[model samples]
Target: MINKMQILSLTALGNLDAYIRYANSWPMLSAEEEKLLAERLYYNGDLDAAKTLILSHLRFVIHISRNYSGYGLPQADLIQEGNIGLMKSIRRFNPEVGVRLVSFAVHWIKSEIHEYVLRNWRIVKVATTKSQRKLFFNLRKTKQRLGWFNENELRIVAQELGVCSEDVREMECRMSAQDISFNPFPDDESSDRKLTTVMTHLRDNTSDFANGVEEDNWEMHATNKLTNALRILDKRSRHIIRARWLNENNKITLQEIANGYGISAERVRQLEKNAMKKLRTAIEA
Candidate 1:
């Protein structure tokens, strides 16, 4: 359940400078105060405690959101997404855990911001693969300066990112490309100047019956392969993977699943990792 105070914060986000100032005005909670509030929320499901925790952490969200300003997205929207992540982290926080809330919340905060950047960065979506996504963010900072990379610089970047040079080159090209409208309006003088709109030469491929049938067959084949792969796993590993990842609306934490099975959270994590490895091998086969 989301706190009402966060909903109020969303309204103030329209004026970003004022929102930042408002967020900074909230006092930071001391270690004892934070732990007590976390315990209340975690153990008792206290919504008031949740509200307090979120209000205090608003400034931290702003600080993290500022780091992604290069993506050309609005600052207010980034803060709003980071706020959602903060709320999610609070919901799952365990006071018994040794780490501080700020330390634990950083991962959730950055994760939400990363998703926002990728979704809005381009119309065509630049980075789909895992390696390409890593390259997309780091490539800009790793480059020496403006302009395209030479061969030596490309090799250096690939080594840094643990990807082949070709991957880095491809990501660089994708990042440099700009989005164009499929059908653009012509200028007032176009007829005399012989200027033509893009729609004039555009071809529609949606009516190709063979291509549509092929796509449907591929999707059905992938789904069947995944079902078969899951069937091969041990019961416990299969449940862990489904609970943690497959249930998108409500993903269970490792600690929660561990408590049910009488094991440590670390053990649950290990099982999840191994299960994913096996599933990948099966699917690829």
Candidate 2:
């Protein structure tokens, strides 16, 4: 156990094997040695004491990092995170506490690694709430089979984790869901199988070429019917129909049309009713 931070000669972890070898080369600190270092750092703020403590405990960080390899994240990154947690514990460790540095550092080390796994395990975060987050970390280990859980398995897992079955099921579904690309690559060999892309086939209701053509054809056919129907009416009736119904911006009212035709407004209204009935019949036919 060690309880101090030291700036090691290690600059980067680009060469993972070399970094691991270097980290493991440091021997573990004995109990007396750790106590002396902790006292020196705590009382006198001795930087050298901190250095020795951190160097001697580098292997512990490595040992703890190996457990998180199941998350599919890079091992070097996990080791780096665990190393941070170890340093954090060293900063807060008190020699008077009577606990081994390794024992005290374990929680901090696992905490950093857990955060890393949650962040990088999936593109979308699988865990949000505290219960879901707890279930997420423990659920993977509880699961024995490869596929989804049966009711028995789900209930067992929920009971073991002390959570509701619904939470377990939700976390399981989240874990099993795959993140997909929004726009698939055209050159990809498997693009055909992954046809679930927005760019490929999402319906654009605002710009439907087939729908636009159909609508235009229907409008033209209706216009031709109305024009033929108007030709069947007398000239006065056609004028009255156009003024009353077809003119969009300046629709002539019944009284206005009546004034233009030198007839009562009621006469114009009767003519409009008769003309609309005829147009409806002709269009239907």
Candidate 3:
């Protein structure tokens, strides 16, 4: 277990035999040896003592992580989580509790592995309630073979597990189901199958392309009419309209235009209003 993390980093796990040979090399600690190491680390804050305690316990972490292999997860990942749990247990272990570190560490190890399994088991979570969570970890143990349970088997499992048959059936369905992509790739093998994905055939009717194009054309035509209409205004009013509304990058206040023309701001505003009325009438015509 001590060499497990280093081996993971420095070598390929693609070859199974070499990996097994490495796991076999770490020495197991006797009860007396483990307790002494635990005491040294707990009482004196000895760094080497803590390392020895952790290193010696890595084999057990591997042993526990292996039990979770049925969930179709990577075995190395499970062992890594269990190792984390073991470190936590070492940090919290009380030598005065009169239990060996391995005996006490089992809960912490299994708990970390349980969390990992639940999170990765499905794209959508199969178990959220307390009863369902209990079933997630222990449900497989109740199964004797492959495929769905018959009526009698469902009743038996439900009674033994203290859950209803409906819950069992629901969980089984969730377990059997696979994740689907909402928007399939263009390179998907079958055009017909790709069309079956939810997003492929759906349309947003509110923003229909033909209606959008017609509205855009009408708007452009109205803009051309307005531009021609502005030609009817005198220079001063035309300048006011362009400054006040058209040129977003360089707009001027009525007072600024009034200062340039040597008129009151009120007079400039009246001219601006008259220009708009004439432009509207011209555009309508």
Worst 10 residues of 2 by lDDT: 2-11
- Stretches of candidate 3 above 4 Å error? 1-20, 145-147, 187-197, 200-285
Candidate 3: worst-modelled 10 consecutive residues by lDDT = 2-11
Candidate 1 residue spans exceeding 4 A from truth: 8-14, 144-147, 186-285
Residues 1-285 of candidate 3 have per-residue lDDT tens digits of 234454344224455445545555667788888888888878887767777777677778778887889999987778778877887888788888899999999999998888888889777888887678888666677774534689998888888888899988887778778987775556566565534556766788777798889999999999999999999899999999999999999998999999999999999999999999999899888
Task: Pick the winner on lDDT between candidates 1 and 2.
Answer: 1
In the range 74-115, model 1's lDDT, one tens digit per residue, is 888888888888888988889998788989999899888888
lDDT of all predictions: 0.86, 0.82, 0.80
TM-score of 3: 0.60
In candidate 2, what are the lDDT values of residues 1-285, reduced to their tens digit?
332223323524348788777777888888998999999988888878877777788788888888778888888788778888888888888999998899999989988888888889988999977777788878887774535689988888888889899988888899989987776557576656643466566677788798889999999998999889888888888898898789899997889888888999999999989998988998899
Using TM-score as the measure, what is the rank order of every candidate, best first?
1, 2, 3
The CA lDDT at 1 in model 1 is 53
Candidate 3 positional error at 159, Å: 1.9
